[model samples]
Target: MSKLLEVKDLAIYFDTYQAEVQAVRGVSFELDEKETLAIVGESGSGKSVTAQSLMRLTPMPPGKFAGGSILFNGEDLTKKSESQMESIRGKDISMIFQDPMTSLNPTMTIGKQIAEGLIKHQNMSKKEAHNRGVELLKLVGIPNPEKRINQYPHEYSGGMRQRAMIAIALACNPKVLIADEPTTALDVTIQAQILDLMRDLQQKTGTAIILITHDLGVVANAASRVAVMYGGKIVETGNVDEIFYNPKHPYTWGLLSSMPKINNGEEELQAIPGSPPDLADPPKGCPFVARCPYAMKLCENHMPEYTNLSDTQKTACWLLDERAPEVEPPESAIVGGAKVHG
Candidate 1:
């Protein structure tokens, strides 16, 4: 697969009365054609902000990119003018948010919302756009799409609304789709259905996907590659198998141990104990140093550079600091795929 979107050293910071908040710091990644990339992290880890910055959506006054370039299809999105970005935002790169109700217009008919994008980007006639709208609705698994199209946002259930959002996002046949917590509000069954629909659509349309989600389970099934974030930086990144089987970052280990296992039951879910560091005045060494179970003197005083484990595996952790004290692997990480810290 070819590269469709590439982000280089992107940083989004906010100026506040209290202090500056570095929501996204020096993050970089690429989305290949027909491939799904999962950005997994706890809340406030800057995953969503990193997604928004690609569209230049961050508020200028408070949210500013200190440094970086958002390269989309060989063109620099950061260099584009506001008017130019407007044309690219939805047509070339679409997004589906967590909540569909907030995204959809209450007054407009659902059909009109989907058709509007078709008419604008594809330059379709009213009749053509309307027909396409119904087709899109059906494509996302909505039954009786033709009749449902005329209904307002309130008429549909939560899952249906989300499907509508997907239909609208896919109306223009974008090269890439950024879905930020797309399954958040729905129940397990609906979430599975929606995820299946997305996977099917991806296979059919070959749309590069950036799946911004916190769920490790979702990452396991949905992504080809995963980038795990903590305190605005991607501390661990690799192919899904490498991430799940050979996780190098202590943060990744913490996340894996925290995942609820059927046999182990609920109470055994081991969450990372400490809160994320304050981005305004984040730790100088490693952001996860406080929460890391194996933090050392070196981990607290100096930031560790990213260590290359393989072509598809990379992690930033002082635990990987060859000079640091050797430590044993966590007992909870005993599994077929999982490997001891290198």
Candidate 2:
């Protein structure tokens, strides 16, 4: 697939009274046409911020674009005006935010909400848009969409509301979809349904997806590629199989180790020790240095460059250095496509 979006050395910072939050520090990634790329990490790892920066969606009074470019089909979106971005937003790169209740307007009917994008971007008439809105609702697996379209957001169940949000996002047939923790508030079953619905829709529409979430299970199920983030930067990126089967970075190993497993009955889940660093005064070296049990002197003093493991796999860790001590990720952590070893 061709590259649909490329974010290069993107940086975002928030100027607050007490400190400057380096929310996104030179983060970069790519999304290919009709592919799903999952950005997985703990909260505050800059996953949402990085995705939001793609649309210039972050509030700017305090938040500023520190550096870098968001290129969509070779066009630098950073240079586009808010007006220009508005034109691109729903039509080309729509987003499904984490919460639907807050994202949808309480005052408007779900049909009207979905219709708004169609009317604005597609230039459809009110009646036409309304009819299309019902179709969108149906497309996202909403039953009785025609009747439900006239109902308010409060009238819908949580899962239904999320479906409506997806309906609105897909209303404009966006080429790229950014789903920022779309399943965060749903129950397990509903999350599965939503994810399944998204995959089904993607198959039908050929929309490339940027799925930002902390759930590795979701990443395993939904993504073609994975980008692991830590302390406001991408620590590792690779195709799903390589990431799960041959993860290189210690941070990636820690993340994989921490996931809850089904077959390991009564086994306590492993959690990575220590918290992510405060970005305001982040470390001069590797941000994972403080928490890494495998930390070495070089890890504490200098950041490792991203080493190419394969054409599609890359990792940033001193452990990959030719002279570094030979170490292997715990066999238990290899749980994506490969067998889990004892």
Candidate 3:
């Protein structure tokens, strides 16, 4: 797989009256063409911030791009002016948010909403844009695209609105799609439908995808690879199978154990013991050490560098360091963890 998108040393910070919050630390990763990369982390772990940073859409005064480069299709988006980014957005990269209502204009007809992108980015004529919007709606599996396009967002159900959003995103056949918790509020059936649509469209368009969510089950079914983020950094990363079955990072282990199981005899789902570290004044050592079950003295005193398990699998944990004493990850994480490591 060749690299299609490379994010090098990306940092995003927010300024406030109290202090500055570094939402995205020096994070780096590469995504390949037609590949699905899932970024999993807790709610405030910089997952959404990183996704938003890709389009240079974050508010400047409140949210600033402190440093680094986002290389998309051999060009650095970070260096591009807003106008340049405007040309790139919707054509080169498009994003879908968690709430369709907020992203979609309530006042505009769905047809016009989808058509706007077609005309702006694809340079289709008014008549041509209208025709293409109908086609896109049909492609995303919405029923009666011709008539439905005339309706407002409120007229459509949650699932239908999400489908409409997907139709709008596919308007220009972008090279990359960033879906930030796209299935958050939808039901199981709707979530499955959306995931299927994304996968099917990805096959047809050959677009790379970045799926941001905390659901490990979603990653198992959809993503080709997974990057486990914590405290504004990637704690573990590997192919889908490797990350799931052979996870080495303690943070990944906690995540796996915390997932709700079916037909299990447990009284209640087990939760991770501690809260996430403070990003404002983050710990000097491993950010997860305060919460890690297997933490050691070295873990508290120093941070770990990225340890290479294979060409495709790497993690930032002292457990994988050659100098540290070897220890096996919990058996519970083995199913998913070993899939990556083995």
Candidate 4:
């Protein structure tokens, strides 16, 4: 696998009447060809903002790139003008938004929506694009594609609409696909079907994916790597196994402890105490310090550097310091009945 996209020290901010809100602060990650990277976090943790930044989708004036570079296929996207970005947006890279209902244009027929990109990027004739649209619809598991292609978005079911969105995003055979909460709107069975469809499509098309969601279960099912974001920064990153089985950050522990366990009968899920930090008047030190049960005085005033736990695992926390007291992860953080020693 080769590196297809690289985001270095990316910082996204929103300018408002009150103050500048740091939506994404010094966030960095990479996506390799034919790989799936999951960015997992709660709402307002900057997961969607970070994903949007890759395509330069965040609106300016209110939203601005405060710092850092987004390099796609060796070209710096941050340096590209809107005209230049237009050339790359749907052809080289594409995105599947959270809600197909809101993202899809209501007036256009399903086939026309899918054909728009093909016509724009591939320079296909309307007839050519329409034919490709039917194939794309069929490829994504939509039945009666010939007839369904002529129907409006409102005519399709929720899952079918999402599949249509996928067909549109994948129409150009993009090298990278950014799926922001692709299954968040569907029921459990439909969610599973969507996930399976995405995996199958990846296998067939060889498109690298960046899946953004709050669900750790989805991450476990689809991603090979995980980046845990909180308070506008990536607190921890590792392979799926390391993140789920041997998480290092206190924030990561809190997230894991909150997950529902089937075997732990009668056990209540533990919620992380306190709200996330105010980004407008953001915390000077570690954002998790306010909610961390093991926070030290140092954590209140200073940020910690990322401690490398393995070739692929790293976390930023004062607890990993040699001088700081060693603490064990709470029993509730244990998954699959295995305890992680700190």
Candidate 5:
């Protein structure tokens, strides 16, 4: 697959009175054509911030681009003018925000919402766009699209609203789709439906997707690759199987361990100790060092460099250093009763 988006050394900071909050620090990742990359991290880990930056969606002044280049379709988005970004946003890349209720215009009919992009970018007539809007709704598995398109967002169920949001995003057939916690507010069944819909859409449109969420279970099913973020940085990245079956970073282990595992009789979920570090004054060394059970002195004094476990897997941790002690992940992190060596 060819590279569609390349975010190089991306950094975003929130300028506050007391300090500059380092929301994202030197984050880099690539999205391939027709592939789903899941950016998994806890709340405030900067995953959402990074996604927002792709389309220059992060608010400036209070939220500044500290550093980095977001290269989409061989152009640098960070340097693009607002006018230039406006052309790219819905036409080339689109976003399905976390909350459809707030993202969608409550007053507008579903057809109008979807038709807005088709009219603006594709220059379709109102009747043409309106017809296409119904097709989009049906494309996303919404029932009775023609009837539903005439109704407002309030008339739709939560899941249906989300589907409408997706329909609006795919209206222009953007090359890239950013779904930020797309299924967070939905129940399990609806979440599955949304995920399946996204996968089906990808198969049909060949649109590369960036799925941002804190859930590893979601990643396991929908993502082709995974990037684990913590303390405003990518601590680990690999294919889905590598991330789930052989994760290297302690943070990744903690996330997996915390997920509720089925068929593991009498096993309680293991939560990671301590909250994420304060980004305003981030730790001097590794951000996760304070909470890591096997943290060594070096881990507290310096941040570890990325170590290539394989061509497809990379992680940053002192434990992966040549001289560090060998330590296995805690039993609680073991998935399906199998160990993941460190």
Candidate 6:
């Protein structure tokens, strides 16, 4: 349960002809050994960008690290040179990108793609790497590993291709594995299988994981802790139970209310109103103030400080202030048909 990775006040910006877009603003979180931390948010909330920054995958010139430090294994990754990062990228921390179809090289054999890291980092011979590739394929539940290894990515099914990506990311037995939307675009059955596989792999390998996704179901199924991101910032974070059952932030309430409930017959999903803020000209006050139902005048001009609710749960909202009016969460925000009192 030792701390393996810590991102402190991390900020990432993208330059454009018009303005500098703050893709991530003072975002922070930590990962423990052999744990799964889910970063859940809608698209463009900076979940992927934050995950990419861990490996220095965000392209420079267009993307730049504006501030903060990424501490992994007691070293600062933001300060590492590209050459230095190269040594740590696949071997120490690895990533399973969103799309296996596009991430995997079309021309290379599946075995060779898996072997590339083994050959580069482990210094294994081509023959040895190929054997390990087969083992990895088999480990990920791909049938006929011996034959599948020699086939191209186009030859495999979508789920199999995703499994291959996981195999590649896990090949080096990395300390931290960042799976950015690993189950994206897959059917429910396949998504379940992938989630099970990831959990099994984490237990077997003792590798910490950072799962980035917009699906609350996926977060509930896989993660122990959750960080709810919105408008390029983490508005609330806590253990899974606290986030799902006792969420404090209005943004978190909106997310929960939107989740489909099987028992709530004929009930419509409560979608959060308004579009997310534009990062290029983000609100000077609370990023969510425009959409929050209980927004005060103070929320329009100043960001609220985070209020610690428990040892593990914290949220940023004017509603949590001692002087602010008390407001109950909308009935739709209830997790299991049980009301959550503020």
Residues 132-219 of candidate 3 have per-residue lDDT tens digits of: 9889889999889889989999999998888898888778988899999989878999998899889999999998899999888778
- For model 3, the superposed segments whose C-alpha errors exceed 4 Å read 336-342
Model 4: pairs clashing at backbone N, Cα or C within 3 Å: none
> Tens digits of per-residue lDDT for model 5 on 116-182?
8999999999999999998999899999988999999899999999999999999999999999999
Alpha carbon lDDT of each predicted model: 0.88, 0.91, 0.86, 0.92, 0.90, 0.93
For candidate 5, the TM-score is: 0.97
Per residue, candidate 4 scores C-alpha lDDT tens digits across 55-138 of 999998799999999999999999999999998989989999888778889999999999999999999999999999999999
TM-score of each: 0.96, 0.97, 0.95, 0.97, 0.97, 0.97
Provide the global lDDT of candidate 5 against the true structure.
0.90
Lowest lDDT block of 10, candidate 6: 333-342
Among all windows of 10 consecutive residues in model 2, the one with the lowest summed lDDT is: 333-342
Point out the higher-scoring one by lDDT: 3 or 4.
4
Stretches > 4 Å off in candidate 6: 337-342
- Sorted on lDDT, highest at the top, how do the candidates line up? 6, 4, 2, 5, 1, 3
* Best of the candidates, lDDT: 6
Instruction: Tally clashes: model 1.
Output: 0
- Candidate 1 TM-score versus the reference: 0.96
